[model samples]
Target: MPAVFILLRSLVIRLLSSRLAGSVAQFLRRTISTGAAHIGTALRHVWERIRSQESKEAVLGCVLCILNMHKKVET
Candidate 1:
């Protein structure tokens, strides 16, 4: 999850500073920030669920999911 966030943030920064300009750049910034905020909220909910889950296997699965998130996004 952290890796995914880093990848997304880097992409957004690169796009905002390079290929985007004027109102389009501002729009993209706002859109990406809003989307990131929403994802953060969702992640908090997921964290809560993971904490409440007592099964070791379930927790491990969640960890694995996060670790592999970047790979999934790449493809």
Candidate 2:
């Protein structure tokens, strides 16, 4: 019947939309976690260098390198 077909179609659409949304959310979570890890590692490295008597210029260079790497990743 037409009514049955319409009901089935709507159900399929709802299922597909929900699945798509879940996939997108998972992807975003992964991206956020990876970016956070990169930032943490960069900061830790910089901090260690500073504590070990590295020059200010050297620390600045390290920060710039990390930022450049991030720019490359974004593209």
What's the CA RMSD of model 2 in angstroms? 5.0
Question: Where does model 1 exceed 4 Å of error?
Answer: 1-20, 52-75
lDDT of 1 by residue, 1-75 (tens): 999999999999988877656768789899999998997788667776764456656766886788688784545
Every candidate's lDDT: 0.78, 0.85
Tens-digit lDDT string for candidate 2 (10-71): 99999999999999999999999999999889877767766545576687787688768856
Q: Name the 10 consecutive residues with the lowest summed lDDT in model 2.
A: 48-57
The global Cα lDDT (0 to 1) of model 2 is 0.85
